[model samples]
Target: MGHQQNALHVKDLNVAVKTPKGMLPLVQNLHLELKPGKILGLAGESGSGKTVTCMALLQLLNPKTMSVKGSIQLHGRELTDLNQKKMRSVLGRDIGFIMQNPMNAFTPVYTIGNQFVETIRSHTVLTKKQAVDLAITSMEKMNLPEPSKLMKKYPFQLSGGMLQRVMIAISMCLRPSVVIADEPTTALDVTNQLQVLRELDRLRTECGTSILLISHDLGVISELADDVAVMRNGRIIETADVFQLFDHPKQEYTKQLLQARPALLLNDQLKRRVI
Candidate 1:
């Protein structure tokens, strides 16, 4: 797709942290393109800079210690040079972020409704009641139960799955063009993982929102992504269409990573036993 059609694009992206001794590169020469209404799966092992890439796109890192270079374009607008005030306008309004930890996404002291309303109001001119209605609507779309009742519940009161669903709801409340989901199902059970994935898929279908889905789960990536990029040691080692990557991965690292998944390993053992 061309630049006009791309919802999010990254080119020559690099991120590094300043250490006492020297700068340590965490990500290098990374590139990604997410088309509207499509999901791009970014998968890798832990400490592979998957989260750093996402954070860098929104300039969430500490500027004092972390340095981000290259270009991050959203809807064809360059974000790398935007000031904090302008970047704020782009963050929740143009690009929503769903963090891995559901508990951290919400405040323990505030009710879910309060947080949702605050987020909506900050990004829009809506009154509190209008924002609440938006929250309830988004929550319903996410398949969350008792939208009105959920508003009254605090983050601590809900289960992890419920909180995750709420987080997705909150992130999509503004109907942003792009969403960066960092291991959205990391803490959920298998059933809840499926639920969260389906909800994300539904958002793409319903709102035409592009997604950068960061996860270590190849199974999760295969289930939801149209395109997949494999990261290793702070670099994008391989990228391909989801089917091609799974069926005929070009890189040895990608192959090993796929085989390392618990479900895939179990399947391999089962096939060996059957033979």
Candidate 2:
């Protein structure tokens, strides 16, 4: 597909951090595209620059400490040119972000309802009562128990999995065109992880939302990604359809990654395997 038709397009992207020695490259000459209603998995080991790429895409990286160079276009609009204030409006509305740690996504002092309602109100002309109703409805759709009560509870009162689901609900509630989920299931148990993954898949299918899913877990990627990109040492070495990359990887590094999967995790049938 053409660049203009893509949900997200990144070209010649480079990120570097300033160090006492000099500028140290973290990600170099990266190119990526996410089509609407598709999930693109970014798989790499820790420090492979997956999270850094997400941060740069969202303009969350500190300009003073890190240099980000590239063109990031969402639905043909250049994001790199937007100032912080304009970027804030785009975030949570146009592009949603699910952080690696859900706990850090919200303020501990605020009740879940307070934050959720405020978020809705900020994005739309909804009143407090309307926002509250919307928050409850969204949470219920995520299958969170006692949505109303959950909203009244503090962030500390919820489990990691619940918090993650809450984050997903809030992110999807706005119906953003693109979502960047950074290691969303890392902190959850197997059951919660599966639930989270299922919820993401449902939301994407229902909303036609394009997702850039960043995760070290190949299992998670295999379960959801339509396309996959393998990264090593801050650069993407291979990109292909998910099945092609898993079944017939071209790069030796990609082969090693596939081989490194636990025997139990690998099955004769890809669809039958549980993440």
lDDT of 2 by residue, 33-96 (tens): 8998999999998999999999999999999999999999999899999999999999999999
Query: Which candidate number would show the highest lDDT if scored against the true structure?
Result: 2
**In candidate 2, which residue ranges exceed 4 Å CA deviation?**
2-4, 262-275
What is the per-residue lDDT of model 1 for residues 173-208, given as tens digits with 9 covering 90 to 100?
Answer: 898999999999889987787778878887888889
Clashing pairs in 1: none
Off by over 4 Å in 1: 1-4, 264-275
Whole-model Cα lDDT of every candidate shown, in order: 0.90, 0.91
Model 1 TM-score relative to the real fold: 0.94
Q: Pick by TM-score: which candidate is best?
A: 2
